[model samples]
Target: MIEFKLPETRYALNSDVSVAYQVTGDGPIDLIVVPGFISHIEFQHELPGYTAFLRRLASFARVVTFDKRGQGMSDRMSGAPTLEERMDDVRAVMDTIGSERAALIGFSEGGCMSILFAATYPDRVSHLILTGCFSRSADRLSEEAWEARLEQILRLWGTGELTKSIAPSEAVDPAVIAQYAKWERLASSPGALRTLLRLNRQIDVTAILPTLQVPTLVLHSKADLQVPVALGRKLAAAIAGVRYIEYPIGDHAVWTSNNETVPGDIEEFVTGRRDHGLLEFERVLTTVLFTDIIDSTRNATAMGDERWVRLLGEHDQIAREMVSKHRGNLVKSTGDGVLATFDGPGRAVRCALAFGSAAKQIGLSVRAGLHTGEIEMRGSDVGGVAVHAAARVMSHCGSDEVLVSRVVTDLVAGAGLKFAERGSHELKGLPGKWDLFAASG
Candidate 1:
């Protein structure tokens, strides 16, 4: 289902240090991604929706993202990088890519750097965009309290504890937490992060905001935990001709969830136009389906990385077809499988069975689970109790079998679909015991 190809990574030399960067797409506009606190340019694609998000941006412009110096693929340093050094790295990357002028999409800590870059090189920046970014490090925190906050980062540096605050829903899944933990370890070590924190404490771009010469846009989620929306509002208020947009949902990693409109918003801002049809985001009752390839890790190991990746592509192709055949929205792919939503329970149940059969034909086994409940739609991503319930139901499934919650069976009562009682069981992470059933023809 992913259409964009991964860009080849290359290094830009800033004197002796090598800064790793990638370029994707061939549109007229060149867009640079200023990554946030934690980043592993290579491992980032492994995260859910990240690659797709980049591809979406690629559709409009040539996208460029690099590991900030001392983070990800960039050369590891003994000390934290200063704003001047980071800016030099950016210019070096721009020169290597032959990009004369480009829009900068700065996220989190990257926002501070972007602000500095835009102010320093007015001739080279086409537009300025900041999301989930803060202009000041203190963020209204008192000196004592701010120090405590910085210390807490040290305490949980490599534990993936940040996921709990930035992505609460995904944090519940052990696999997601483990992935984030590994990313933390790869991005920077505890000692290096400590050094960075000491330097970050002094960051304050408020004084330079009004002097920015390029067009700017500021976006924030009212509920962003990592960078409060208040800081975002303050940043926008200081800019002379800036546009600010706030969403009802909050997640620091807006590209991953909730703010599905983010890409479209960026598109409109940069291009002066946008796709009229954005995914409808609203709360509604629907049948949510979850499918997982059985023993995916083991299978990946046995098949080897390259072959396994090809197989996943095949699986995704079939899954997408089946969802469309059943008139369901394929919300997103879950690495080995997919999460989808359907208007009717019967079609979702049938699609699961059909997709399962198709998987076996390719020498793969898949288990599916379905539940009908109220789901909160955040653009293209779906979340809420119903979504989690469906994943839990799938976890209880056997190889190649299709399972459904009692709610699903009840909804499809007279649709001619038969379900065998699987009895009551506790769905992990959800309160209370619930009856589960196996769907059959």
Candidate 2:
């Protein structure tokens, strides 16, 4: 395993607050990365491809990353930072680094701030790059829709739901989702994030788009869920002579999936050289596991809303822990169940069995199913025939039974696990009959 050495953290005073910053590499060109709504410089490095993504850029530039005021290692703030305050934070970091001018890589909400900063202080910015950015938050959704969205986000803030929603492919692995959940919690409190999102809707930079004098590059994904591809197009259209590249596929984040592509593109855009080849997408073979709570609706109805909500929270927490413990990825909690993936079919079955045992301690009856196949990564989510097959196997499961498909059984043969014939069953929406089995230690 390649060890990643985290850049030494330094403090840059952003007014009364100390904005935490880290610098990597020492190339001629200086680059400042503007973070989105949530950022934790330390926690972010834990994610796969993120460090490599930075390393790719660092190969040609001096890269600086920081946690904005009120987030991550930076001092907390009582309220969201306005664009002016954000600009001040940037200036503070630059001043600390003794950088006269630098290129800017803005992501999501940070893109809005970067645009304003570049336009306001053109002399200070060498180049402007926006990734998965939108021109106006309000333009993306109606007021009612935005409110509902904010509510939904806050409701699931620390539960790693963002990965499922924004990056489904990553959600297929429980480890990624679990780490992301920790990152989310460390990035900001639920209340702080709520404040930030509320003010985000008020951001309107469309009027300033044409007036920008700095050279700009707009990189967006065609299938980004958070900031729609259409909005990204409109954002690019408003800018003057902006070099825009809408990738054929990706989600909100650029650090994973086809991560190296962006850095190579940035290298070319800023330095007039393309030195890296395209990295083929990461289709992987793994076991998909599905766990469902037996009679979940009945349990919820009998428990009532308040009690059921608390109980569900416990169940979800336990589910996440078990998935992580067994080296599985918890994709998302299905209200009464969870979808996860494991590299080994045996581990997948063992996780389900362990989870089932855990759930019973809390008076919950859970069943699980497993199948092994080649799965495609859709953003952070995983899908393919294997996922559906696993779900179908679980649907046919008896109460407290860990069921699996023949694919799973075949993969784990002679691995010290045993299974009983569950009979031939026709899975809905899938062609052909499937032979199922009841899995046991």
Candidate 3:
């Protein structure tokens, strides 16, 4: 029999709304664990698996778990709150604890909010740990799949049937499954659950990720049914300098089942036992390329559905091949455009030039922008003011043209990639003025 000594649960810093949390252990480092959908700090310790996981984490650091705003002990609002608002609740809990900085451990939907926090408030975080997370809600599951899942939640979430849909496996102990369903019902109202799910579907943090400067560890079960593992991989790739660990557990709730392994990985990541393999340089240099199709919407509408799909496939193949030829990594596809990264500014410039020239033959024109600067690497993508600057530069150019920032010019001075200065321009969302130039033919 496991005798769990439960910690005293308390409320912290009441805004118009207050957040509820519990503090346990007396380790040197402060660790804050954000809940997924429904969490009650007081009730959590009663579950054997949940209790064991927390105790394990507490061995290395003081653990803090909190109910998110509008759920559990926190005040319930009339409407669904934004991810930013939920993050404020997390901040409130931290402030209450007098924590200068803490390692953030977020599970499931909590993982998305955690990423946003670490990116938005790098100074407040010592490290970030995300499990089963996605950069955007749209990318996690397809539209049809999302609708189906939502329907299941709405129909069965509180009916003691939610566990049937989420158990680690069919062989899971019935007692354990019933315990989870009970917690789900106790921790949140149906309205609150629906609202949280809505927010999860609409959340997008792809743009803000590159600005994150803290050490990050991303973990996801390769066999997770709720959130696909590819989304996790995409998240890791989008953020520069992120360490990703893939586990084989199919459960979305890691601490509940297959409990030991999940918490152990988190403990290792938080305690510095695992080297995140981050390098320190005064300035890290990388090339940024932004490519957009010419008259994309018009082309899609004109070509109709079938023909347009075929054309886009051809365009994707061409762009991918050209990007690969120049040793560029395809960061992501932005609707009709593609964003890529290169090791050398010169290669990026040449790739953009070649891509633009080749695109015209296919009745397409690509606008590109290149810059080199110290970039914060999240798993697969490069980010920071530099990445945004490159995107802004791309916006100013016309179809079939490639532009380069002055920083890129300095890096590839004798690379034979000629450029004609476009002079200074004020870019939106960027501080100060920037010097821009057009790539020469």
Candidate 4:
């Protein structure tokens, strides 16, 4: 099941304008998703397919999504935002989140912005994924034809009339059309869309294509009606060492036609592995341990900085020793705590108990949570829903307490690891209620 929740939206200031943005997940890589034409941040999750698409992306990386100036929940502007201005908005969002580098995933018109951002700020971009994108708007339509199209859009705006143009495959479905209409209405007013579209047609990032210094992946549908597949091919050909893939489907919308196709392709390109085991990624049933010192801020205040630092150092060393003693891999330290992975749930349980004992000896109260589940191995890091579940399990813990999910209790049934039933709780951003137990032994 997908982790379902409306991510809390925050604002990133670009000059005086507030760019609405949201960040989700905690994977090693950071991804910034730039939306096409218009978007409503919260309204996006209302559609099941779109939510699933985002959840799939969030499964592998920390995703940062935002609304540009004069669009959805962001500050309204007087005129259409130029590529440079929109690029500033993306940078602002990244800066707000302290993201030094991120992979840019841009869809449709946003793809043009992504290209400009990647080309202009090569130092900040690690990888680029552009879907149904074009480098030169002039190649797609003549001036007269473009003007005529703009007029048509103005006339049919907000009435779900562009469903066929947007996603021809879903045009016949009334429910889909109705939902798209509502999304369009919430995305922007007719006047705003016209201005954005006019500006979008003026975008020509062809000159910067050769200057891109990062790996790029270009995806397009063969039967896309809005932008021809040839445009997508030309875009890929301009960039150095860019991988291009064209699907057989006809829809221009990224989340529709083949929902899994887009995310699956992206997953393979970015991580070198498809979701269904196409590449080198490994899946192992392992135990995850999350621990943190209780009331660390208060403790630090009472002990003072020098003494606190010394005690914290000792605490980390003890954690390392205990994890090693239990044959666990020290994934990383969380400043006030540590996250480790173990081969056996029983050993993991023993390690948590040892941590509590060790912390008490050092006059530190540490709480821990453990869960056994399959995890996606990403080089030295790990991800997937299990890690998120483990984190939520940790949040439910109290001072000097070691808690674990039911999976851990079941796995260590005969290992003599004692657990007191803690009942079930609904984990934040995760699906369903999970039964938890306190690791007493």
Candidate 4 TM-score, C-alpha based? 0.62
* Worst 10 contiguous positions by lDDT, candidate 1: 275-284
Give the residue spans of candidate 4 off by over 4 A.
1-3, 276-441
- Across residues 1-441, which tens digit of lDDT does each residue of candidate 2 receive? 112366999999865889999998888999999998889998888775577678778788899999989899999989898988988999999999999999999999899999999999999999999999988989888888988988999998888888975676678777778888999999999999988888888999999999999999999998788888898899999998899998998778888767667888898999888763222233557889998889989988999999988988889999988887776778888888999988678888888888888899989999998888777778778888888888888899999999998878887889888899989999999989999999888
TM-score of each: 0.66, 0.64, 0.59, 0.62
lDDT of 3 by residue, 1-441 (tens): 112357887888656887888887777889999777677777766453466567667777888998877777777777777888888988888888899899998787788789888888899999999888788888866899888988878777755565554445532445445666677787887776777787678888888888889989998888777678998999899888999999876567676566657766776777756322223211245688888887888989988999988877877888898887765689888878888887667778988998888878888877998777667777666677778888899998977889888888887888787788788999998778889999974
lDDT of 4 at 62: 88
lDDT minimum window of 10 residues, candidate 4: 276-285
State the lDDT of candidate 4 residue by residue for 139-164, as single tens digits.
89999999998898888777777787
Name model 2 segments beyond 4 Å from true: 1-4, 276-441
Error of 3 at 371 (Å): 69
Worst 10 residues of 2 by lDDT: 275-284
> What's model 1's overall lDDT?
0.87
